[model samples]
Target: MPRITVAEQAGVGLDGAPRPSEDVVLVRPDAVIVLDGATSLRPELPSGGWYAHRLAGQLAEELAAHPDAALPDLLAGAIGTLAAAAGLTPGHSPSSTVALLRWTADRVDALVLGDSPVVAFGPDGPRVLADDRLAAVPRRGGGYRDRLRSGTGYGAGHLRALRAGGAAMDRLRNREGGFWIAEADPRAGHRARTARWPRSAVREVLMTTDGVSCAVDDYGIFPDWPAVLRHSVDKGLLSVLEMVRAAERTDPHGIRWPRPKPHDDQALVHVDFTEIPK
Candidate 1:
């Protein structure tokens, strides 16, 4: 059996608030898991981390027990578990983006629920696996949520906004939009992004929340991913925390940007998939 190497990090953004946890994993044969929680300013919804922890723990178990289950089925099961564990009425409860990558000798299977992204790079180039509505929003000025809130609620108007959101997402993020996981709402619909990996010449794999993905614009598709992954491996979760701290140093609401988006929490998990045994 080939061994697997994994790393994760969480940090406060330039705004000085805690970022949400956004990475989750269920590595089979060699299990590795990362879960990220979304941070919210609303005092009424304080359990983003709690929700992520519970969902990741339970989902990891379910995936471990039945590694062969369908991706959608697995997600449905996880969602049910989350709703029950958090006592969330489908109407209430903080929702999160979920991404899982499980691989075997010949295939790599991935699943994504929200805007959090999953990206893969290899000898060929970069390819995106799972993308969500949030991917479309302009990340430069906190347009991701700003655009979401500007739309009509969850009906047809909301779906239109989401579609419009993607069109608005500029692929200028350095390496282009390789796959990355992002935060999302459950009511957002079934348009999940998924893929099976090709082992030949594959070099790297990354699963990150919007915080890191948003920064990808700074690096492009492959960006400084290898360094970022290595940093996470060396510094552990705190490495990501530091990145969030760096983003926080900018002050989202500072005079630098005139009007600024509310500071949001962030988490990122970077892995050298090639480093994981095939």
Candidate 2:
């Protein structure tokens, strides 16, 4: 089996309270599972982190029972099981992004939903697996990002704006031509983007939630994917997380990146296939 390393941290809210991270990371004998719970805008329902933890728990059980199952099929079944338990329709439930990778002696399989992503370092360098549908969805003009840009920080008015934007986004969730996430709808699992690679072609693979990936993609911490991977190998995934947090600290008011939070829950897994025994 390949050598594996995992790192995770809960994000702080705007108020700097120490809240539970909504991200989950599971390292199985043959797979890696990463889930990022959606941020909850409402006060009544269970938080997105709660749902993500539940979904990750369910997936852990299912994957252990069927190690050889198709990635999407397994996801769909687990989702259906969760939906039945909740007795809720697709849009009515809390949601999360999913990034899963399973491997055998011959090949490796991956699935991506929401913004969570995977990066594989192969002979040709780095290749990315991501779900961009959520980014493609139309968004409100004066929402969170706009508020951050205008120096509102995260306040009551910012929360209101966030909710209004979330309401608009909720309408598009799980709908045709809109983005798909792991919610009450099982079909969204089937809609996840999937990919495969020859085991021999891949040297190392990294799975990360949007919190970490946004640093590489949006924050421009590194020039490219190769640099990101190299840094992780040189220092560690925890160091990367620290670097991201440090970057956020420099711009406490969100004038630079204009994100929803100063720090997001960071979850990452690194698999070193090269470290496998001969």
Candidate 3:
């Protein structure tokens, strides 16, 4: 069997509230899953974190029951189950990003939706598999933090602006020239990027939510994906989280990165396959 380890932490919100992390990590004998819940703009419905937690639980159950189901089919089933339970309406519900890796005796498979990432370390080195179409959307100037500090401080106006922005972005999802995400729509799952590798060729794998990966993606804390993996293997994933927090602390005003929130929910799972018999 392969050896697997995981690390995660919830971050403080803009109001300094210690909310539950919106990320989920699940390690099964045959698969590893990581999910990142998107923050909700509307306060009426259950939070994105709540939706993500529920969805993750459902996915785990489904995957365990039918381990051989195709990845897209499993995701579709999970989305269908959750949409009914949460009374979610198409294009109007809280959603999450999905990153999954599954292995069999002969091969390994990976799928990524939204911005979450999966890194495969093989004989060729490290290959980062990420879906970054979300980053292509046209965003307004000034980060969410900047708007919060503007005058209202996350007041009704701020929320309205957020809702408007989200609505505008929704029109572009899962379409040509637009990005795809795992929402109430099962079709999004088909849009996810999937790849397979010979089991013997893969040495190890790493899966992470955008929060943890932002260190390399946004902060430039590490030189590359291999460095990030080496640091995680040596010092644990929390070390990377601390590095991100420290860097954000130095630029709380968004002068450096210009992000929405100071800190985000972080989660990571590392799978070591060396012990598995070749």
- Scored against the true structure, residue 81 in model 1 reaches a CA lDDT of 62
lDDT of 1 by residue, 1-278 (tens): 33344444544432434554434444555333445554433347645676676777777777877788866566667666656665665424555567776665666667776556666667766667655445454355433345434432234443344334433432321123422222222322234566777656455667766556655543232255555555556676456555654654564433332212233345554546555454
- Give lDDT tens digits, candidate 2, residues 1-278: 79898888889864657799999988788888899998877677677888888888889888999988889988998889988998757777889999999999899999998999989999988889999998888776777898888888877777777788888888999988989999999998899999999999999999999889978788899887788778889998899899888898999878788877778999988899999756
Q: lDDT values of the candidates?
A: 0.52, 0.87, 0.81
For model 1, give the 10-residue run with minimal summed lDDT: 173-182
Ranking by TM-score: 2, 3, 1
* Candidate 3 pairs with clashing backbones: none
Candidate number that wins on lDDT, 1 or 3 = 3
Error of 2 at 44 (Å): 1.7
Alpha carbon lDDT of residue 274, candidate 1?
Answer: 52
Question: How well does candidate 3 score on lDDT at residue 145?
Answer: 40
lDDT, residue 162, candidate 2: 72
lDDT of 3 by residue, 16-102 (tens): 568888888877778988999888766776777888888888888888989888888888888888888878877788889999899
